[model samples]
Target: MKSCREATRLMSESQERRLQLREQASLKLHLAMCAPCRNFGKQLSILRGISKSYAEGGPERTED
Candidate 1:
């Protein structure tokens, strides 16, 4: 079993690149029992959506 720290690192890395099969399997197994990591994964998805929208010109930022 992977510790939450390792699992979370793998989870973050997965966002940028594909994880190995064993690593994916381990992350899946850990997330199956870990609520916090699962929530983190959801948050990552939300962030990705928001970022995509921003990249596509959904909004503009201005200096205060």
Candidate 2:
């Protein structure tokens, strides 16, 4: 099993889909067994999602 720190570090530098799968799996495993790490992973995921939205323009789309 990978440590939370190690998993988080991998997540930080990971970009490709395959790398993300491994990082996310490690993160989830740690989070499932550790409350603190769960919070940490949740925050990181939320932050990443928010940042991605902002990078792509934080606006709602409407169908015409």
Candidate 3:
């Protein structure tokens, strides 16, 4: 089984490049059994989306 460190590394690297089939399978298996890692992955995706939106000038902020 892949360790949390390895799984997190894979998840992060996935953001920069495509993972191999074996890597994907291993990550999937690890995520399925690890709640914290799965949550971290979800949060990572959310942060990536937010970053991309800001980079793209997705919205303007207004002061309340």
Candidate 4:
């Protein structure tokens, strides 16, 4: 069995557009069986939602 950190790393490093269906299924399977990794995924999702909300409402900062 993979460590929680290893599974979480694979989940995070995976590309949304590039991920195969099997890869996604595997990640879900791992998360379902691993409490720590599941918690990590949940927190990551929450943080992503917050960041997206902030970016949509906050002033735009261009780096040009």
Candidate 5:
């Protein structure tokens, strides 16, 4: 099993390009078993989507 550090690294790296089949398998296995890492991945995906929205001027988020 991959360590959290390694898993996180792979997660980040995946943003840039496609991972190999082995890497994909390892990351999937790790994310399945690691709740924290799974949450981290979810949050990362959300943040990325929000970032794209901001860049595209999709909407303004009012601060209160």
Candidate 6:
């Protein structure tokens, strides 16, 4: 089993590049058992989406 630190690193690296099959398996297994890591992964995805939206000019704001 991978430690939380290792699992988090793999999750981050996966954003930049494709992980090996073994790495993918390990990360999947870790996430299955670790709630915190799973939440972190979800947050990472949300942040990435927000960043992409911002890069694309984001949503329009109206004066209230």
Model 3 alpha-carbon drift over 4 Å, by segment: 61-64
Clashes of 4: 0
Rank all candidate structures by their TM-score, best first, as comma-separated numbers.
6, 3, 5, 1, 4, 2
Q: lDDT of each structure? A: 0.94, 0.72, 0.97, 0.76, 0.96, 0.97
Best by TM-score: 6
Candidate 3 has an lDDT of: 0.97
Model 2 quality (TM-score): 0.56
Ranking by lDDT: 6, 3, 5, 1, 4, 2
Which one wins by lDDT: 1 or 2? 1
- Model 3 TM-score, 2 decimals: 0.89
Candidate 4 structure quality by residue, lDDT tens digits, 1-64: 5577777777677624456787677777887788888888878788877888898996668998
lDDT of 6 by residue, 1-64 (tens): 9999999999999999999999999999999999999999999999999999999999998999
By TM-score, the better pick of 4 and 5 is 5
- lDDT, candidate 5, equals 0.96
- Candidate 1 Cα deviation (angstroms), residue 7: 1.2
Q: How well is each residue in 25-52 modelled by candidate 1, as lDDT tens digits?
A: 9999999999999999999889999999
lDDT of 2 by residue, 1-64 (tens): 7886886666565533456676678766766787776676668789888999999998798999
For model 3, residues 1-64, the per-residue Cα lDDT tens digits are: 8999999999999999999999999999999999999999999999999999989997888999
Query: Which pairs clash inside model 5?
Result: none
Backbone clash pairs in model 5 (N, Cα, C under 3 Å; residues 3+ apart or in different chains), count = 0
State the displacement of the C-alpha of residue 30, model 2, in Å, after optimal TM-score superposition: 2.6
Better candidate by TM-score, 3 or 4: 3
Model 6 TM-score, all chains together: 0.91
How accurate locally is residue 48 in candidate 1, as Cα lDDT from 0 to 100? 92
- For 7-51, candidate 5 gives per-residue lDDT tens digits of 999999999999999999999999999999999999999999999
